[model samples]
Target: MKFWQSVEHAVTPAHGWAATTGAVVAPVFHYFYGTGRADILVVLLVCTALDWVTGIQAAKKQDKTYSSEYGLSRLPRTMFFLALPALANLLDRVMATPGFLFYGVTFGLIYHTWNSLTANAHRAGWPVPKAIVNLVETEIKAKTERAMKQKEGK
Candidate 1:
């Protein structure tokens, strides 16, 4: 084959795969995040990356080896984080409460991740104020309890 034909042949399969993946993902993404809200996912991913990096640094500071196996464990955690907001979005739709559950769950997860990141930062030798840590802990606990009570009431 000629050079341009060879290049096209190589790229054609990749283009097909990209189109197929986009087709499968687009609707699900739109359903979960709604239109023009990809920034929510981007923020979640960025926060997750920061947490992972800080966790690795903390492990190093503590003279512990952060293995790839442990890093791989984060996949499930990240999936849970993503799935929770999707579920909340569904709940919001069911209740006809425009974006309330979705945004609440997403922001809650982000706040929790922020807490984890701050703790990791402290472990990695950056000092975080105790009051801020306490407040975060309290908020998380309150939210958890409220969720549990709501579940029980239902």
Candidate 2:
């Protein structure tokens, strides 16, 4: 339910705290602030537990059961996430500043996250574009319905 846990649930459904933090959060902080590697590790441990709970919710919603195999599959997802920070670091060193590295890596993560999400959605037999459109439509419907209900109540 925490911020990082939410991020993990969004990006890698089966990810845990240790892998997410160690691969994603710690590296980001280490590159950005140049301190608190230890803090990152500890926080990730807690977030991993939180990820499991959220993963369960996600699995139930999708009508699938949880398994250790699924959790372990997130290892590759963690590696993919980690690549951005590593590239950022290398670019920072070569470019003599963090600007390009930071933005480039940020965008890379965004793009990769979207691509992965779309792929997973497709694999789950939810047509990607239609699913996105449905989500948007659903949001609009909810908002409109809420407003109408409020008006009637008033």
Candidate 3:
């Protein structure tokens, strides 16, 4: 108990940042890994890391000052994207929709993952062709708009 208390004291966040993160992520991590679905979590973690790293690289490559302010703005969005699929999966189970919502959301997550990766690549001056970038951007926007319209219709 003393050792645990000492460890807790050492690792505690000044505010609630660390605790909040653990509370949100730990259960998901446990559930996936515990059920031998760790590959899903691993893929997600890898995508998240790559997105952040490339985002930083892009910022440094583009911005003369490279302030952390812009970077901080992305964290909440990243956290939201990371959590969205899991929530959709839970909803699928609750609704008993035969994987429809889960698959749809998972596809969206993966599409957005690649889209972000492509954007980061372009921003980092990776020679992404203008035509391909435009095409993908247009398609993604259309798809997103369709989803929004459908949601509104419901």
Q: Which candidate gets the maximum TM-score versus the true structure?
A: 1
Minimum summed lDDT over a 10-residue window in model 3 is located at: 29-38
Candidate 1's displacement at residue 113, Å, is 0.5
What lDDT tens digits, residue by residue, belong to model 2 across residues 76-148?
8765555555566667767888556655665565554444344344333455587664544544344345435
Q: Give the winner by lDDT: 1 or 2.
A: 1
97-129: candidate 1 lDDT, tens digit per residue: 988988998899888888877767666676778
- lDDT of each candidate versus the true structure: 0.76, 0.52, 0.66
What TM-score, over all chains together, does every model reach?
A: 0.69, 0.38, 0.58
How far is 108's C-alpha from truth in model 2 (Å)? 3.6
Can you write out model 3's per-residue Cα lDDT over 1-154, one digit (the tens) per residue? Answer: 9999988877756547978887899787654233344566567667778878866676567533345775697789988876776677667667877556655766677767767766766666777789867856764455345435644555
The TM-score of candidate 2 is 0.38
Q: 1 or 2: which has the higher TM-score?
A: 1
Instruction: Give stretches of model 1 more than 4 Å off.
Output: 1-11, 63-72, 126-154
RMSD of each: 8.6, 17.0, 9.6
Stretches of candidate 3 exceeding 4 Å from the true structure? 1-37, 127-154
Rank by lDDT, descending? Answer: 1, 3, 2
Cα deviation at 107, candidate 2, in Å, is 4.0
The count of backbone overlaps in candidate 2 is 2
